[model samples]
Target: MCVAADWRRLYWWVVLQWVVGVATSGPCAQRCDCSPKLPLVDCSSQQLSAVPEGVPDATQVLNLTYNHLKTLSSRQFFSLRQLRELDLSANMLTVIEVEAFVGLQNLITLRLSRNRLKIIPVGAFSGLPNVQFLDISENEILVLLDDMFGEMPSLQKLEASENDLVFISNRAFSGLPNLLELRLERCNLTTVPSEAFSRLTGLQHLRFCRLGLTALPNNSFRQLQRLQDLHVSRCPWLHTLAVNSLIGLNLTSLTLSHCNLSAVPYAPLHHLVYLRYLDLSYNPITTVLSGLLGDLLRLQELHLVSTGLLHVESGAFRNLAFFRLLNVSDNRLVTLEESAFHAVGSLEVLRLDGNPLACDCRLLWVMRRRLRLRFAGHAPSCVSPVQVQGRMFQDFAESEVARTFTCRQARILTRKPQDVRSDEGHTVLFFCAADGDPAPSIIWLNPKRSVLTASGRIRVLPNGTLEVRYAQVQDSGYYLCIASNAAGNDSISVSLRVRGFPASSRNRSGSFFLDGWSFASGQTAVNGSQPFPFDVKTLVIAVTMGFLSFLSSVALCFIFMFFWSQSKGQIKHTATIQFVPRSSASTTAGRSTVETGRFTMKLI
Candidate 1:
């Protein structure tokens, strides 16, 4: 008897609820065109060219997306006055006429994304006083008029990204005090007026990326009091963020990647105590000021990749106690000094690769000793002469990528031995030296066309020295010496010669001898015992070597010329042949002309 009574009571309650629903939905049913059996209406992805008037009466949800609609007239939606959510996304709409939603007084959510709408007239949505969520993203909106969104008194979320917006006027969003999220990414905006966004006091999330913004004005974001996440990345020309621009943001995540920023002031970001994730990757920043990034006490992840940094000064990261992951790869760093990573005790994953690290004795000491470190393996192995080439640290190291690493060598200049004085015929010496890895070998070229070695007349020093017993005037030609090592090779040539003697006999003896010994004016013949002081042996050797060099140069030049002529099919050759008066030239009195079949030769 108790179970039967309970069942009867439940049945009566259901009937009473149904009666209430019918009484309250009478007005909605009379305005809409949908069936009374269903409360929601759906016309999404139906290739609709215009607003559908076939909706059921008492409809609450209307979807007509993925269509080819070019316009939305206010009269078309005047019948759907009971709709609560309307979706018209993924259409080819380019315009919204005046008072487009004049009769949608009960509309709460509106979506019009992925359209080609270029403009939205003022007061277009003034009729929808109950609208809260509006998305017009992926449109061609070039400008936002002053009062384009002033009628959306109840709007909370607005997305207007992937557009051609160049400038956002002041008071464009002045009436949107309830807006929580606003995205205008990739809008091609070059300047942000100081008051452009001052009215959005309650906004929470903002994103602006891939726009060529260079700098921000001070106090640019002072009005946004509840902002939480701000992402501005992949802007190559951006450099500075003005002081206190993010004063009232109270943000949780900040990203500024590929911005070409070299330095940042620490005081500007001090107010962001709630920041958790910060990314400054793919920039050209070289130095981090003391206590710069350390001010972010709540930071959990920091990315500093490809920043061209060379040194990390101690205490640079002293205040990052809350950081969990740090990436410092693709930089020009050679070594990490002790205590460089001191305050990163809370770090769990560390990345340090793509850096040309010199693994010499100094770095070896660092590898063997430093304590309290928490890394996976040997800092991913310094890719010295071996490059990492777009691969990760672990991947490059796992393939035994260290075998190609080697040291670089220095370059040296070489010269040939020459006579210092023509009268005395004193022998001159030449040498070439360079500091290198694997030590370079020096080859000396002598006037005798032979490789020189260390022995009396010709000597070679460990420091790469070449000496000649007696230099002569004939030893005046090009001499080349090469020094090679692991890194590369270099060669130099010096023209060797003797000093010219004076033309007069008075410049050869007595007072001339004394002056000759003191100065170079008369310093050729000391005793006048040897005529010319010519070393025949040295001269013969030098002449022979010079002749050989000349012949070789001529042969090489001819070979190059032949190949070049064949490649281009052009021969530039012209000769002028002169003829003297012949003894028996009485036979030809006229213009003397000698010609062959296809050759014309004239004598003048």
Candidate 2:
């Protein structure tokens, strides 16, 4: 009894649903599905050779994709006055008779891709004036005649890629004054159709790809004033861009990928001051030369992936104040200099993956700001210096950089000190300077190979200058100056000969006579070798220290007075600025998503 009751309820519910559906929807063709409320008709993949009967007159959107219809006869869709979108893609359409679309006055989009049409009827598209988007790609269109699409005055975006389009007449695009975007890819254009492109004065975006073009001649895009984005990619023979090729346009986004370019066309791009995005990937460019991009001040994103990039010379990105992203991946780069980006303070994303980077001092700024910089994709790792090879820059501690990234050695910068021939009682000085990482320290050694300490007659200043006040005979001999650091050391020698000192009175340990006086084995010898008191030398050192202290105090007092007076007379700021050899990020107009060769980039 319970099962019977449930079956009766279920049958009634089904009957009610069927009645409601039929009443709401208008009469549909036996082969087509129609919804009166939505005003839509779908006959896709029906394998029909002709239009089915009983299609509602109120249908506004018609889909006939994947069909077998070969021809479109006159007035076939004359009654569908309210149709706004028509898709006839993936069909065996061979011919379209004149006036085939006589009543579609309100159509906004028309797709006729993947068709077998070699030539379109003269007046097939005569009445579609309000169409804004048209796709005639992947067809056998041989040549575009003058005024072929002149009737569609309101067309804005047109896609005609993947066609055997051989030649385009001078007036091929004469009627599309309002067209903003056009794509003409995979065509048989041996040269740029500048004459046809000149007619598109209002075009803002253009994509002309897969041609046999070797170069873009001067004034190629001179008439495109409002143009912004341009993609001229996948041309193996395109190796050059004429110096004045982009003279009169302000493009924002540009893609020149998959070309045979040997270098960046920084000369032609000098006119694109408003360019914000650029893609030059898959080229054979090896180096980013210095100041090559000084004019692209507004450029924010750059793509140089898969280029055989080896070097980024210092100042390569100079004047790029608003740069934000740089993709130099899949290259043979060893390292980029920090000084190269002194003008790039606002860059945000830096991609260095798939590169053989040597984590040296040239890239020290990157490791120092590892946390702050956003390294896109894999983190940059060292490919050299055995100890740090294959290790990410972020994996090392801040202190480790100082210990690892070091110079090879310390080199003495000055020439060898000249031999000094001074009379007794005259002062002598020897100068020595060096260059090294962490700065080298200076020390002096006597002829006896003993370190010389600062005292009454001998001293080494902070500037690495050896000063000996009141030089005597014993001071005559070889004086060696050495500069040393953590890496290595360098030394130079000077022979000091005192005129009045007798060599016969000198000892084997380099203790020579100075006016009948010498210090041998910590003993003072006078004439016949007798011990002497150290009171005289000690008194002279005391007097010299007191006098030097007095001068220093006076100098400080004068300096304070001068500064105080200057403050009262004129005000000065206490703020200071330092220019360290460092580099970082910048800003841009906005963010977007663009697909490139199967790789999608989310610009920030």
Candidate 3:
């Protein structure tokens, strides 16, 4: 044994150089692509200007996307401590240094989307305490200060939508108490800071579309108490919403579409009692009043499409029980009041075509109620009466439209003769045609009964015609024409008579003749030239007492139709005569034949 084979050949050459330095230290790394059966490290779009040191310390996905990586300094992935996904998204990232995600404590997804990140400094996400998805969306970041996402206490989704984000400071997002989802869409947020979402108390989906928010103030979303889908839309200068904004929201789905909202502030949506799905579509909201969506009792689906709505009042969808789906399509609705959907008793999808719906009988309760309306078969037509204009509401016939549709009560179809005389300063029209069913309300009261108010030469027109213009003499007497609806009121008076010259005949001056002929002696005279004598025996006794009062009203209407046709034919021949009372009659007849012997004559 020559010295025991030289110490066993130097212990097999030091175990072959320590197994060749652990097999060449594995993660290859020249221009990255380390895979090793999937610990992945692609180094995407590699035009890399940094962040590429020998990766693979068991790298757990680290795609430096479209890389031109500019400054992410401090410990930039200090040898990928088993990085759990870190895609410096489309990077040209301008500064991130602070702790620059210190040694990403198991970073669970951190993208930094399309970056030129304007500002994020404060601890630059200190050590990404287990970052749970953060995007930094299309960034130029702009302003977010305070805790600037306070070092991601397990962030749960944030997008910073197309950011140039105007200002966020306060507690920036108070260390993200597990943020659920926040997008800040197209940001330049004009104002929302007061408690900037009070620390997102476990936020649950919030979007901020094209904002320049004019007002959403009061406790601005009261710390999103478990917010559930709140998408603030296009915000054209937002338009006030304060009353405790969304009080302690536990919302389900609230959109606030196109937001130039004219009105929808029912005490800040009455606290969204677990709101279900409400859009407030394209808002310029004209009218939807009655208790304004009641209290949204767990409302189901209500969009109010193209909200320039004209009227929806009647109990405005009451307490929307479990309201199904109602869009109120393209608004300016013409007529709906037959209890305007009475209270949406679980309405099953009703879009109401594109409105202008005035299909008579007030839509006959939607064609005699069976409401399962979906409107895909395109119905809601009738813009109005020209014999059912475009006729469609399910081709109507609810009892032939409730027997030829007649809501009659306000009947004043202008039959003329209510005495009108206008000549003072001329101009007089009157005319009021009414006949009703849901279309009445004419109102023109005047002769001191009040209500006639259309100023300067008086007007009223729109078909109910009144137009007085220059007629003075205090516009003479009685002028009603009321005409109400819901089947009731029906006025008609008229009698105007504004002739002329009577302010005590212009202070008794004389010579008045524009057809109201008067040569002097006056108390007011027209045509009759009164002031005394012209009596041909009282004009033959007033034309024989008006021709004996028109033949005494035609002999009292022919003696009341001949005694009402002889008392209606003696009550119909005494109910078809039927009397056979005879037994004792036979006996009495034979006895009376003589009264003890008299000649009895029987006649048939």
Compare candidates 1 and 3 on TM-score and give the better one.
Answer: 1
Candidate 1 lDDT over 1-604, as tens digits, reads 2223543654565466456664224433222334344455556666778776556545667777787789987656887788777888999998898888888887778899899988887877778777877888888988888878988877777888788888788868868888777777778788765586778887777777878788766777887778888888877778887786677678898887878778654667887888898888888877666666766888887778888877676567767777777677788876554345545446676666667766533243333332443344535455443454343333334234334333456478434443333332565667677666545778776555556566644456677866654444555545557787545777776556665445475354221222343435555331111223334565568899999999999999999987887798655465455554445344356765553223435532
Q: Compute the lDDT for candidate 1.
A: 0.67
Each prediction's whole-model lDDT (CA): 0.67, 0.80, 0.73
Candidate 2 local lDDT, 1-604, one digit each (tens): 2223433654564466455653324588778877544567899999989777677776666899998989999988888887777899999998989888889998878899999888875677889988888899999998887888888888888999998988988888889988989999999988888999999999998998998889999999889989999999999999999999988888999999999999999999987889999999999999888997888879999999999999788789888888888899889997766677844458678888889886666577777777778987578888877778999877898889877765556788888558889866567888888887646778888777777765546777778888866566667788889987555789999888876535564332233333555556776432211332233455568899999999999999999988887788755544344332223232346654333233333422
Candidate 2 stretches greater than 4 Å from native: 1-25, 409-604
State the lDDT of candidate 3 residue by residue for 360-468, as single tens digits.
5555665665346566555677776677777776776555777644466777888677677866655688888887766787878777676765544655777787777
Query: What's the true lDDT of residue 534 in model 3?
Result: 26
Q: What TM-score quantifies how close candidate 2 is to the native fold?
A: 0.65
**Order of all candidates by lDDT, from best down to worst?**
2, 3, 1
Q: Is candidate 1 or candidate 2 better by TM-score?
A: 2
- Number of residue pairs clashing in candidate 1, backbone atoms closer than 3 angstroms, sequence gap of 3 or more or interchain: 8
Best by TM-score: 2
Find the 10 residues in a row with the least total lDDT in model 3.
Answer: 525-534
